[model samples]
Target: MSYVDLHCHLLPGLDDGAATYDDTLRHARRLHAEGVRDVACTPHVKRDEFPGVAVREIVERVAHAQRRIAAAGLAIRLHSGAELAHADALLLPASDLERIAQGPADARWLLLECPFDGIDDDFALAAARLRELGFGLLLAHPERSAGLLAGDGLARLRPLLAHGALLQVNVCSLLGNHGLDVQDAAVRLVREGVAFCLASDGHPGSREQTLQLGFHLLLRAGASSTQAYRLTQANPRLLLRDGVTRPLFDVEQRALAAAA
Candidate 1:
């Protein structure tokens, strides 16, 4: 099955991802070769960092990118998305949320960027607020978060899971590119069935964005083919197709995104 990547920085000139249109083309070609047919152009959306990245502009960029990639005869399909900052998610308008949402209009699934520095008290508050505002969250790179990794990591993770947030482990973390700590957390999340899916979280030509290598590394890291396919293919596909996906492979993850 073709892989569907939900957290790719494939759009050029947006955030720290692809730098130019040509860079995007090269990235698309590589992804196509890796059997990735669909990609989400998830640019960073943080008030302090990417303050100028408006939702309307992201849509326009994706539309322009779709045209460019198609003309290049690449089979890759592009979708609009943004790695929304927790601070911004609390204030962005409902209409803007709908525009940058992952799946259909009714399915408000937000790719919430987990803070790399340290997850403060507001992280859970933001997640709960988003859910209350009718948005499902895909928490990015929890394995790398200093807050989640320090002292009883799983214990801290439980509250977020109870809040209906789905964990998205980065592919690079699985391969130990981030460090032993990140790799261990990532593998443990999968083994314990806490992770909801695997994402490239790819930006331009970064090696971590290389899905083929990441998949192989995951295999070497002790994930079976069934787990790999579920993480890379089935779960991601369903999330993009329907906004919310069920845990067909992990019973422990079943409580994710369920209505209270």
Candidate 2:
């Protein structure tokens, strides 16, 4: 089955992703080979120590990359998006925010990345503010946040989930590319019904086979075949189409299952 990647850094020379036009084309072909036909070229926006492109420029870059992919005889499709870091993302103008949405001009999905160190009160406030602005938020890599993994870490994410924010886990995290802790969290999120989608989050030098690997791993870790398909394919498609999530594992039941 073809997959939809909601978070990938495939744009050339924009932030820490593909470094050149050639790299962009190569990455596209690789993801296509792995069954990823549709990808969101979601480069980091306003991240510390990394240069983020403006939303308009990011949209333009995706278009340019699409042309290059077509010239190279690839059918991979690219969409415009940005992984907005919590702090500086607040500073982006409303117009730029409108430019970076995935589908139509009114698409509500906004891919957001919380700090790697942890999620705290301020970050939650920023996310809440974004939601208030009418965006249906999709969180990126909550597994990597140490604070979210500590004592009641996953518990804290429930309120956001209840409010309509979907979580997107990195496939590499499930494969231990990050670490055991992150891998554990990733698998648990999928198995317990907390995470809505699995993404490659691929950069220039990463593996193309992660989509397949993560899918199988999720099954091994207790995800049903249907749930596996949902995370890798169906849920992402729905998010792209509707800018909202409907994971096979019910979000409302997560806490109940965990408590039991």
Candidate 3:
């Protein structure tokens, strides 16, 4: 099965991602060559930079990239989304949240980027607020946060997971590129059934350095190709196609059973 990169910085000139359209196209072509059939253009929507990347603009840019890729004969599918930073949580209105919660196709799942700190009560509160406002959250790249890897991190994250937040870990964490702690935490999360998905989180220029390396590490870590495929492909498809709602996980079985 072809992979679906759920957390990629592919939009050109949008934020700290691809600086040029050509670079974005080059990254898309490379992803296609690596067997990624679907790529979400998750430009940063943080408090610092890219505060102006509205949903409409993101959609338009993704459409433009799609056309360019098609014209270039690349078969990869480009989806539009915003990586909502934790700090930006207080800044976004409910409507803006709804807009970015889904993709261009209005898939209800939002790609939510957590803070570098870790899962905290504030995050749980934010998750609760989003839930109340009617959006499913996909917490991005938790493995990079030292706080999340500290004492009883899983315990700290349980409430958020229970409240319908899905954990997304970058494949780089599993490759030990971020360090042994991140790699160990990632593997432990996978083992404990907290991690529901894995993404490349590939930036344009760094595609070759991260994307394939993450996939290779997941495969070597004893993830059956099918299992890995689901994380990289099926789950993302669900996020892009399903409406906003918490995904149903069979916590007892340590697997996602369906989308709720």
Candidate 4:
């Protein structure tokens, strides 16, 4: 199956993602060429800086980008959603979370951002609250979290996973660009069957980096291609669906075999 990038900075002039419509178009073209059939335009909903960007505004902007892509005859489908920062969690009204939770192509999963600091009980409670309010959470790049990088990070995440939260690790982390400890943690997460997806939290200037490289890293680390595909493609597709929780073991086993 063609890949779908569940997390990306594709929307033009929204936050620090793509700076212009042309830049957006360029990224779309690149994604299509890389066989990315769908992409979520995950502009930052960081609480510290972009508080003014309401959920409705993000939806409209995403719709506008989709229109532009269609007009330009790009084969790739662009979906609108926000990479909502942890700080913006409670700040966004329940209604707004509902609106922003909409995925690129009729998807139900929300691409949630973790705080740069660490995951805490409050965050976990907030996530549970969101679930209670009927939104599926796809935690973005937890490998970057210092707590997750520490010895006991996985223990903390185990409960969240049981609570229907899916984990997303950035492709760059696998490359050790974030640091060896993070890379080790990211590998361990995949190897131990913790992370559900590996995405290229691709910025505008760094279009050359692809999730394919991350897939290779996972495979080399003993993940089967099927598992890698599931994390990089299948699971993400399901995530884009109605945010249903699925078993991770089968795919991880398949991915390990494929890697072998």
Candidate 5:
């Protein structure tokens, strides 16, 4: 029953995640005890505020944690990825985008975060641009986004999904740590089968964000054991192995070629 967390902030000094190396070690132990065998260190990449995490920095910190985990005999493995702010996706050049990408080095799964305040009218365009660049989009925590909570929320998300974007929900959202509305949204997304995965989005302060609790909560919310495992493990594993998702639109390789 090995689990993989596709979104987490376990690296120290990168963003609002773990504050130091010691904190990262503690997070690793907790995740290992909770039955997570692999984790993606998905720090923030909002260009205005957090911008993006540096690839070298992520590698260095992950190496440090791996050595410590080996010394402590923990079995957890680390992968690198970023939670891109929608604004950054539009502003960054393709080459710069490549540097901040998260996932296995061979894979191009970019975790994207929508605006918390609201979805910009042009947000869909930004998502399309990323997809055109050949990166698979894994949207992070749409249930927390105010835009997704209001109006025809599900309708608003349809274009992104149609464009082959996958949705990820935070564990905290399922457990009501974020609030009743967010919990409802998370549960609704899970129950409706709209969400492609569940993640800790864990950044050090909440018990509600553990992967183990999330797995059970999904079951309690109506997901069978196998379905829960697919969200937390199999689907993400497939993303890493396949490197690209089914394109939402007719893809023109010219964009990727030009970007390359």
Candidate 6:
């Protein structure tokens, strides 16, 4: 079975992902070996850090890299996308926003980075404002946020789902690749059915085998085989269409059954 990665830095030179065309090809081969058929080329759109990265530029570069991937005979498909910074998401002009957005034209979606350094008050306002502008939010690696599920934590995170946002947990975080807190948070989110999907969020230095490891860990950490498919495959494919998220009731009900 193939998987779709909603958040991955497979495109070269835009961020900390692939450095060159060769690097991009290598990442694609690795992803293909791991059974990933589709990947979103999410270069960083953080203005302060990656000020030169533009929506049009990212799209063009992705196209160029895609041609290389095709010519190389890799079966991987790369979709043009960006991981928008909190401030950039709110401040970017309408034209840029339109060009960068994913999903159906009527109901688009954007991947907003949930800062690992810290969470700020403006994060909520950005989510609200973005929703007002008619784009769905798919937060990147929210479980790795520094202040995970603290005093205002669940208060902040629960609203993501309430606002129709999808919380994407990184596969590495689940395997304790980030830290204990992140791993714990990842587990909690999955157990509570709060995590909408699990993504490789693969970058240059990150492990390529996370897809296989993530599937195994998800099964060990409470997800059934069917539920793991939903998290890694079914839910992500819907990300391009209004950031759709379906329930993991199959596993939840199974747990309930076991409890009863």
What is the lDDT of every predicted structure here?
Answer: 0.79, 0.78, 0.73, 0.75, 0.76, 0.77
Better of 4 and 5 by lDDT: 5
**Which has the better lDDT: candidate 3, or candidate 5?**
5
Write the residue-wise lDDT of candidate 2 on 66-145 in tens digits.
Answer: 98899998878888898888885577766777677665445566898867878777678878878777777889999998
Per-residue C-alpha lDDT of model 4 across residues 189-257, encoded as one tens digit per residue: 788777888888888766446676767887976789889998888877776764544354344444444
Output the lDDT of residue 138, model 6: 82
TM for candidate 6 is 0.90
Summarize candidate 6's per-residue lDDT along 43-78 as a digit string, tens digits: 898878887687878788878988998998889888
lDDT of 1 by residue, 114-142 (tens): 88776767777788888887887888888
Which stretches of model 4 miss by more than 4 angstroms?
Answer: 103-107, 206-208, 245-260
Worst 10 residues of 3 by lDDT: 251-260
lDDT of 5 by residue, 136-201 (tens): 788888998885756555567677676677788888888888789888888877777677789999
Candidate 1: residue 223 Cα off by (Å): 1.3
Clashing pairs in 1: none
Top of the candidates by lDDT: 1
Model 2 residue 102 CA deviation (Å) reads 2.1
Screening candidate 6 with a backbone cut-off below 3 angstroms (N, C-alpha, C), the clashing residue pairs are 103-240
